[model samples]
Target chain A: MSKKINLTLKVWRQPDNRTSGRFEVYPAQDIDTDMSFLEMLDVVNDELEKEGKDPIAFDHDCREGICGMCGCVINGQAHGPDAATTVCQLHMRRFQDGMTLVIEPWRAKAFPIIKDLAVDRSAFDRVISAGGYISVRTGAAPDAHAVPVPKDSADQAMDAAACIGCGACVAACPNASAMLFVSAKVSQLALLPQGQPERDQRVVSMVSQMDSEGFGNCSNHYECEASCPKEISIKNIARMNRELTRAGVRS
Target chain B: MASSNRTLLQSSIVRKQIVAVTGLAMVGFLIAHLSGNFLIFAGPEAFNGYSKKLHDLGPILWVLRIGLIAALLGHVVLAIKLTGENHAARGGRYAVSNSRGDGGFCKKTMIYTGILILVFVALHLYDFTYRDKTGDPTIVEGVNGGLSLGLFGLVWNSFLQPWHSGLYILAMIILGFHLSHGIQSLFQSIGFFHDRYTPMVKKIGFALAILLAVGFISIPIYVNVVRTPHL
Candidate 1:
């Protein structure tokens, strides 16, 4: 048997950082307790539109478990206390009636407040560009078997490569450090022979750029991994440090 | 493209290693610095005398100083180089599309704060360490109990001046920002960081960073405000 639940929603609303931002509350009832979090938002938006009030604005797409766009703090946990998926993947079945939901954007110095629920995450792209890509020579594409990378190294690279570049890291970070993201970028590439040319410079340049962006240092808050929908390991950050050190030594 | 400017910046992995090691070394320096400063409670003779002893370390001190300077320079330069490369990439934020940042690691996200601390470092080196050694910081002699050589007086005077104390606090705040991320992540970067120990490490790192921030700032605050003789 399914029981419809009632709840309160206090969500941050702002047209942009320039204007005043405030939290607005609404009494929501008759919601399917088994709906995804976004589904719950959808229900609220419908109610708001019917009442002729402006519906809350939020970032989400591909209601599935991929496409790192959906975000909200259900109670306090990013993406609502689920294991390795984003908030869009979160279902209301996990919630009880009369629960209060607080939705806010990722807060950080580098991530400027963008509308009600969106943040400018360009800084991350810049960090990736710093050395995230590998240089491949043009001509006949080499056979996949030609590289001869060890299986474990390949697996490790794939694991690090799984990062979706969501700013959840910056948002979850108290100091807003970006080591995890930078490290992920570095580790994934460094593990493969194809990434050797750029590996040294990639780690060096990306790490340097990460610092210049005004982000905080990584003090190892696993909130990033905890908040990560993919559940990326904190070990990648360690790998980045190692690479940075290795890069530093030969530089 | 010929390995010109691109190559120089990208030349060696050793350079990156130097930066990381230096960063770790600086942390070690902070610990030693704190312990030595505590000698103030040891009475003026022991304290100022300790400073003199450090100076008395002589030729060996010069070598260490050179090494420290080299480390600092290497770290800073590489850091700057890396920063430029990141900016050159992507050129701007991603288009407003269906990309939700995935969940894996939240902390992989702090290159910005790490950079901010770099700026703070320049200001700090200029203000405290450099100024003190040169006596440009206003060192006085024979004021406190023994060998008052303006060391204690300089420290007390700087903190009491409000602005100096504020700057000291500001530097400490930046240091706090750096350590809060660095210490915990250092374990991660080094690879000992794990799922079971991640939470413990985070708490330990945060606590230590906060403690250092508070302790270092307390010196300037205490000397400048509460510890003022008139106060």
Candidate 2:
């Protein structure tokens, strides 16, 4: 058995990219506490549809906290007030009856609002395309033990690999700097033997792309780490800085 | 392909490296400056002799002065450029946000303190170097049978005024705030930080910042309280 609760939502309502947006309040009546946050939104949208009003638009896929599709600023926090959890995984029970939730899209130059809460995250994809892959042939898979990577390096690579590219970091950052995201990509590759072939070129290209994308500089605020669903450590940023210095000197 | 101009000019991360290195160089200069300033505690003769030695170093002194000036200029120019880009990147501000703990006070106020320190540096140079050059007869007096403005007497007289000493103390406090973040940030920017060592590095940075601030502040206070008014 689950408890029922009523709440109010101050959600951002934007029709398109060219026009300005504002917060519109909605009454969320008789919501189940056991329901997931997205399920709660589904109920609200259905109510708006029966009345012939425009439904609130948001982005989400694989609501299990992976795939990195879901993102929004819930009450000024990226992905709501939960720690190390995505917006989709957030449950309605986290809130109390009559609580007003202020929701808005991620406000960054690189991430423009597409609708109400969905922003275009293609800028992140562009950054990845710049140098986020290795140059190895795909003819056959190598033996699992052939590389013999050090255990410490393997663990660090895995840690860096945890980033889901959800853009929460950009949303949380005051400067909108992508140091955490870019550093995660650079660190994962820099720690492996396969990623070494293009290590210098990768860092140089990726960092250049990140800058051209109009992201801010990291002043070591550590906000990205706190808001990150993956909890990616900022140490990766230091590593990327080292790699860039090495690449700059070598080139 | 050779390193493009973008790597040095437009690259925000690379610009950080530039700022970090130049900032560290300035820190080195501060340490040397504080050491020389301690010479004033050895009484007027020792301080005047050290000043004369520096004055006699001629061409070497010019080289050092030019080097310091270039470093300061590079640090300031890159800081302005990077800060502008960061401001533009934010695009818009959040309606409701909180940065209680994660956003450290020193980290956010780097620009403010940095600008303040720059203003202080300009005023300080004018007060000491320019005033010395113009030879203000009252502040600059003869010592050790020589007709030159003794550096010790000039420094002593400047601190005799309450406003001058107060401003110097305030500027040092601001410098402490700037350096508290700066020294630790230098290690990260240069890629020299480690998870195990970084904590200790931060502690050292904090301690060094306080030490430098107190060291500099003591001079004005000592001159005001202990030394007799020879000016």
Candidate 3:
């Protein structure tokens, strides 16, 4: 038989960003240890649906954690108590029987709460739209060796490229700074040859857009790196700084 | 396509760089100031001589003062602006917000300690420079027949009162708190630090902060405990 546990959840619920929110406690009974965290929430939500109460609204897609869609502060952690694991990937076994979890949406001015445990992350989309893409022409597939990247640069770029755009960095920051996320996007391209033509313009535009979207500046608290599911390095922020500084000086 | 009219000042990162550079300038000033204060341990003659040399610089002294004031203004103004931006970034507070490592004390209370340091600087100038200019005979005395505060006498007399010494000591501690975080942050802000050397950098910052606090506090302690009032 599957090991089952009963838990209490203190979940934040609000109709919109303008309205005040409060914690709504729900009893989660007979939760299977093999189920993922989101699965356990699903069970509670199912019960709420049956009772004719407003079903708890949360964000989740590609429950395996790749989509960057599912996230919430589980017991003050951006993605629950597991390191480098998203909330959707966190299994029920991590929690013991009778434990209570406090769940809340990402609380940043850039990320307004849409409903219970769901925030409007369109601000991220705006930041990305500002400069996250390479402006190159479409052509036939070139040889893989045609544009050979240095091994170290490739690895570093890949490391930064792993960022899932989860907004966890912003959520985890004390100042709600989007530096880690923005830097990841900037570093991923800035390290590559394909991203060179517009590198200077990209960094400046993206960073300015980030400020326009109302994210705070990085103070090197390292909390964003700590909470990132991808383990994105705060060094990426340094790279972004170097890029921005050089671009500023040159122009 | 679109006319993007963004100046360097409009960029948040650049503003931070300005803050970092100016902050480090102030740190440099603190180190020099602390070294000068250390001359007091060599006795009043050495201390007064050091003060006399500084006072003799005349117009150059005004240049240094203006430069320091400009740095202070840049640090304080940007700090205030960045703080507002930081506050606005958080839509609201979490009910059960918790953090680990750098998120604690020094990182969190930067603005508070910074404001305290500003207050301390104001009081410090008033106690040492302004008082001397006003010809307040109680706070000034001659050294070797020269009609000046003798720097050493000014420091010693002010620290003679327990309350004055207490406040000065407290301010040094606060300055230490500010520096511990400020030093490393300035490095990171200017892109000179990384995680590989982060532990070492943090230790350096901590050591420097402790040194400043202990170094500055030693003066008041020495004045109260060891030095005899001589004019």
Candidate 4:
């Protein structure tokens, strides 16, 4: 049995990138406790459609916390207040019945608002396109034991590879830094055997791209780790620094 | 090749490394200064003797002074540049902002505390090094019967004023706040991190900060409240 609750929603509404945004209040009556946060928004959007009002625009895909599409700052926390959870996975049971939820888009110079809650995240794509790939040829599936990767290295690489590129780290940082994201990408590839050939070039290119994108430098606040949906560690940042140093020395 | 190296130096992380290195060098200078200042407890003869020795070094002391000034300028200039870029990165402010409370008050207000300390340093140099506001003409006997300025007497007279002691104590407290975060942050900035040792580094940094603050503050308290001018 699920309990029904009424709530007041204060959502940021911007028509386009050219217009400034403002918060608009909407009454969400009889929201189910079992409903996901995005589902609650869907209910509100349906009501707005029936009343001939424009639906609140937000980005979502997969709705299973892996797509890295759904995100918004809820009550001053990115992806709501849950640890290791995305906006699509956040349940309404976490909130009080009459609580007023304040939602806003990701605020960063590199991530401009496209509509209401959807900011352009192509800056991350641009960073990836810079050097985030290994350039080895793949003819067929090779033997798993050919490379003989250490278990510890393999596990650490997997940990770094868990980044979903959600841009929540940027939103949560006081300086809007993307170091955690870029470091994770750099570390994941740097730890593997196949990543050895282009290690120096990859780190240098990705870091330069990240810097040019107007992302702030990391001041070691650890806020990004706290707000991360995948529970990424800041140790990756230290590793990235070491990798940068190694690249500098080798080049 | 030179141009490419220059580009690497201009990168955000490398610039931060420079800031960290220079900041750590200042920390070393502070420890040396505090140790020398502790000689004040040994009475006027010992304190003035120490000051004379420093003055006797002549050109070497000037070199050290110039090096320290260069370090301070590098730390301030690069820090301001990074802070401006950081401000611009956040395109706008949040209506309802909340911190995750990662490093607390000390970590967030580095720039503000640093500026206050800079102001205090300027006034300190003016009062003690350049200008003699206190009209004490006491001269201490030096090696080879040479006479040196009684730095001990001047320090004591300046500290006797409540306003001067109060300002000195306040500046020390601000320096403590700056070092509490700065000590641990410098290690991380220079690519040093560990699961077990990093926590130890933080605790050591905090203990060092508290020690330095209390050590500096004790001098003024001793001069103003404990020791009489005649004694």
Model 2 score (lDDT) = 0.86
**Candidate 4 second chain TM:** 0.89
Interface RMSD of each: 9.3, 2.6, 1.8, 3.3
lDDT of 4 at B128: 74
Error of 1 at A45 (Å): 0.3
| Residue B10 shift from truth in candidate 1, angstroms | 15
Scored against the true structure, residue A170 in model 2 reaches a CA lDDT of: 87
**Isolated chain B TM-score per model:** 0.73, 0.89, 0.89, 0.89
lDDT of each: 0.68, 0.86, 0.87, 0.88
Cα lDDT tens digits, model 4, A59-144, are 99999999999999999999998999999999999998999999999999999999989999999998888888988677997998
Q: After superposition, which runs of candidate 2 have C-alpha atoms over 4 Å from their true positions? A: B1-5, B133-149, B227-231
| Candidate 4 C-alpha lDDT tens digits along B145-219 | 333336776787678779989999999999999999999988888888898999999999999999999999999
lDDT per residue as tens, model 1, B140-216? 43343332344655566566677777766886887787677666655654555566788898799788889888878
**Model 2 Cα lDDT, one tens digit per residue, B124-181:** 9988776753245324333333344466767887887899999999999999999999
Model 3 chain B worst lDDT run, 10 consecutive residues: B133-142
DockQ score of each predicted structure, in the order shown: 0.11, 0.52, 0.59, 0.49
Prediction 1 TM-score vs. true: 0.60
Record all residue pairs in model 4 with backbone atoms less than 3 Å apart, i.e. clashing: none
Q: What are the clash counts of all predictions, listed in order?
A: 74, 0, 1, 0
The 10-residue segment of model 1 chain B with minimum total lDDT is: B90-99
- The TM-score values for the models, in the order shown, are 0.60, 0.93, 0.95, 0.95
